[model samples]
Target: MIDTVALPRPYQNYVYAYPHKTAYRPLTPRPAIADLWSGESTSTLSLYLHIPFCEVRCGFCNLFTRVGAPDGLTGRYLDALTRQAEAVRAALGDTEPVRFANAAFGGGTPTFLEAGELTRLCDIAEHVMGADLRAVPLSVEASPSTATADRLGVLAERGTTRLSLGVQSFIDEEARAAVRPQRRADVEAALGRIRDTDIPVLNIDLIYGIDGQTAASWRLSLDAALAWRPEEIYLYPLYVRPLTGLGRNVDPVAAEHDWDEQRLRRYEEGRDHLLAEGYTQVSMRMFRRLDAPPQGPDDYACQTDGMIGLGCGARSYTSGVHYSFDYAVAPREVRAIIDTYTATTDFTRAAYGRVIDGDEAERRYLLQSLLQADGFSVAEYRGLFGRDPRDGFSTELGSLAERGWLDDAGSDRLRLSPRGLAYSDAMGPEFFSPAVRAAMAAYEHR
Candidate 1:
């Protein structure tokens, strides 16, 4: 058996905050509709709608979505989404109406659909899901090729507060190295169109650690992204996972030490550059402009509140359960799942997921907040669990403290020092429950 304890630097075991979908198993004789949502608060919730169709697949992407659907498939998928939304809203019941405080549209790419289909997508969120898109902060993900004038116009009219464009790299050669087929000229044009729509906030996503990428190329991409004065930016490290385009060509273990050093240096370079440009680091991956208006609901906390997700790839969260439809990484397997989803009529019960016990919930609460720059609050954790985190996670906390990864200045909170933040990928999984780790190891991913 492989020793997970000694995994190399930049240990990308799991993203943390929640167990990966791979660990989820089929819920045989699925939980009852009422029981699945029992005791779930309706005061405030987040709505996530998935559009699992993209124009093209990126090399490093392992999200539970498929590339461009065939002709008419998009329409059928939207129809299925509408059916799912109706069923879900009904499941929430009339006794206590759930109010959505924030909404997001993610997928392979939500903008891959035609302009008219995009309108229908918004309708499903508003009319079917009862989430007033205009009232809630709505975020939509787009790509250079698909952020057309027509689509941007529709999104703006439908109250999309934020537009997140995936510009992996502004350098043409670097883009090619990442196996993302797009020209710098096209990316600039897409940015221009997005600006024309006057979306309240713009977010640009960039990746580092691609083959042939250097500090100079990284700076070029950062400079180009900064030119837009985006409200938020996400810098992601390239992780070539199994079955991905890049994974097939690269050996993850080969030169692991060298790759880790390169990624760390580039990450620091990007972070420092953004900070100098007047952006505040929210976490290791996210940076936001200090002067920009708030984009999300201030009251919604991922750990405590519930989330309603629609469509095949979206995951829903209640107090005790985190569930979604079947997940896959292989292209053929993904296509089959999407096909099955489009034909489904029953959306009341979860198909696959793990039940979050009290211990798992505490772990999630700590991981999610401690990873943030603001850190986790001892007072709040006490209020929720009636005990100190150090009592339950004493060994883990003590280890992190001994390694100087934790901030020792504050007694009321636990925050990561700069070094801890740099090794976040490793620090996150260290807190996972043993049961979760075993379950994830047994999962068979395609």
Candidate 2:
């Protein structure tokens, strides 16, 4: 049996995207975006437009977004987005039909822009990029404070199927502790506004591991969210990192064991509660109501399809390359990057990113699939690479199996045991390539 004692903390890292942007560096003699997409299948691409403006920066946020925009900054940013979209659309070429399978507007807070600006943003996706917003499943992220009637109306009119609201805590005191300025009354009103619109799926984002958050208090937030009957609920474990508001005073190393234990307990409790309430677990952080109408096409797989990300804060992915502009967390640096992006007239080439080799591709496929609650098909892996995961990942699979993390039911598929799902954070990092790990490590977090 594998000895669990020597393993690191369970919440080591959250692997939302493989070979994270930190591993990306400047690509010398930058490759033209056209050349990168040339010969690649353009059908069923996912589109993402990023809005980097937020009303308030959450204490725990490390996202690449500025707190507020200057008078004309939002306009200038939109102009830049329009120019970039034109360049990308042209690059996609005319030989084959380019179609979007799914679309999303994310940020800091996408709804941070005014109503008319939101309309323009959607126009860029539809008019410039050729995505049929009305046909595809469109998801947008917003904060309770910014989920206004005007913004919700624009999103609904644009065929936004999902609206993800960031409500860290519904309790007034907890919200204050998390440095997210809002009241339960205001959040409820915002939820009401969202429901008044035609947007079908409402996702409430809640966080655990806040100071003074107990099982009872956590239930308060959960019950409040459930009362709204949101289609989706995302429970995120609070992570304090450098340059964030909460990181300023708290020592990340302090109370290590106790904090991990508390977070794990909360996670398990939340998971069980949601499961009992008929919410299906999509991932460690995501739970979807069983009756919630499904959005997006079943055939659009994130692992294989190309993703076109518009804006300074977003990243574009092709088969071989994942590229984006400079990334930063500090407000000043973020502003500088955004300014630089808006100033540039040339949006033709990839300025910075990392190349995905054959080995890294396999790792990405396995890691992204295995971390999900549904697990992955070994047959699919064999079909893709001509070899099964058991051959490529013998050591890692052995360790997980011995530790009782792997559910070795049948050879047709590979799945995580209940205990394995709980340790997804640790398991994900275990699959990172040494080169990618070194690149991420050497990246100086600003």
Candidate 3:
């Protein structure tokens, strides 16, 4: 019941010609076992359930989804999510009774579900995945106007603890022009209601540089957002992507409007404002409570080892391979994921593509593992892969130490220094493939 097909050598050669390494990811020399899911289970696991339905699709949004006309709606889809969880369970072998807290319902808008459907999906996640998701953090995305008291209650009762509300901008005009729905009063009430339930954290997402926004107005929204005192705040700058309405309106100089000094100034001023508010920098775009660890990639990677992404336009990362599928997928890529993971249940690194020689594997392990704030741990690395990262990566760390990008405090811990944190976004992709490394490095040099 599995497709054992493989890409011909010619296609693999064609793929390698371009710099899209992920395209040819399952290359030989990855892991040696048939099961890429081998080794000790990680401390956490995350599931990104994409709900591709939205009441209104904003002009700037590029996520895979449909709006309003609601033709393909059904409860069967929710059932499918649970079923996929089972298929994953079967594939993962003895899933090490892992303790997982984080599962995010993301999308064009996850709150697109009507009350009954929303609660049902939560129930499905609990029934299938919660068998192992004991005493852990569980969260979901909320749209201000749609997430009413009743809806919040259902999510809270059904194990949803954290709520990341899409409060893009507080200005009514900008909110309307961006086609995002928000009401200062409504959002305040909703936050108050959700807080009453005593959920551990509330993350408010803020965006800047919409078509109608000026630097002053953007600053106003930032200050208004800070008034709520959220446990977390995420700032997203508007970027023009291919094929969207905003993309169509791109200015050669400014991807959004004019891409001028004003836009860059807004980013710099906003960055300064957040730091002044006592928000320690995490990733380039995220800031969080000083007491809480910076979130995103670092906190994220710790919990996410092998993700099982379901629904449209989701990406899954495992030991040596990253599998992605949309509502539609490139035929070759889909076939490869199915064939590589399903066919070779006990499959190892070689089947993935390149042979992950010990040195290469150690190098990669360090890059992927050290991506977050907690940094790389020598003991955990040895426990999982049977060797120390110190043995393979100390040379690179020692060299990087002089640049003030890394620190090995008392715990044999490695972390990005303050200066290193500032340029991390620019520095991150260098750890990937050769072409990406060149591109990122060139970006920095420019």
**TM-score: which candidate is best?**
2
Q: Rate the local accuracy (lDDT) of all candidates.
A: 0.87, 0.91, 0.57
TM-score of each: 0.96, 0.98, 0.69
Candidate achieving higher TM-score, 2 or 3 = 2
In the range 263-371, model 1's lDDT, one tens digit per residue, is 9999999999999999998888999999998765547888789998888998888888889899999999999999999999887788998889999888888888988
Per-residue lDDT of 1-446 in model 2, one digit per residue for the tens?
35644666888889989899889999998999999999988888999999999999999999999989987999999999999999999999999999999999999899999999999999999999999998989999999889999989999998999999999898889888988989999999999999999999999999999988999999999999999999999999988888999999797658778888898999999999999888999888999999999885645788788899999999998999999999999889999999998888999999999999999889999998998888888888899989988889888887788778887845688988878888898899999999999999999989
Q: Write the per-residue lDDT of candidate 3 for residues 1-446, one digit (tens) a residue.
A: 11232211110011111122333334333443226556635455666676765676665665555564234343545555555556555555565664444576777577777778887777656666553222446667877876787777777776665788888888888887676666678877777777777466688887776767988899888888788777788776665544454555666454322443454456667778988988766654567777653233323453235555655345555555454432222233333433333323221123322323344445556655554544666777777678655555555555445555665533556676654544344344444555444542453110
| Candidate order, lDDT descending | 2, 1, 3
Give the best candidate by lDDT. Answer: 2
Q: In model 3, where do residues sit more than 4 Å from their true spots?
A: 1-44, 69-72, 93-101, 131-134, 177-185, 252-264, 291-304, 327-420, 435-446
Task: Supply the global lDDT for candidate 2.
Answer: 0.91
TM-score of candidate 3 on Cα atoms, chains taken together: 0.69
Pitting candidate 1 against candidate 2, the one with the higher lDDT is: 2
Model 1: clashing residue pairs?
none
CA shift of 421, model 1, Å: 1.1
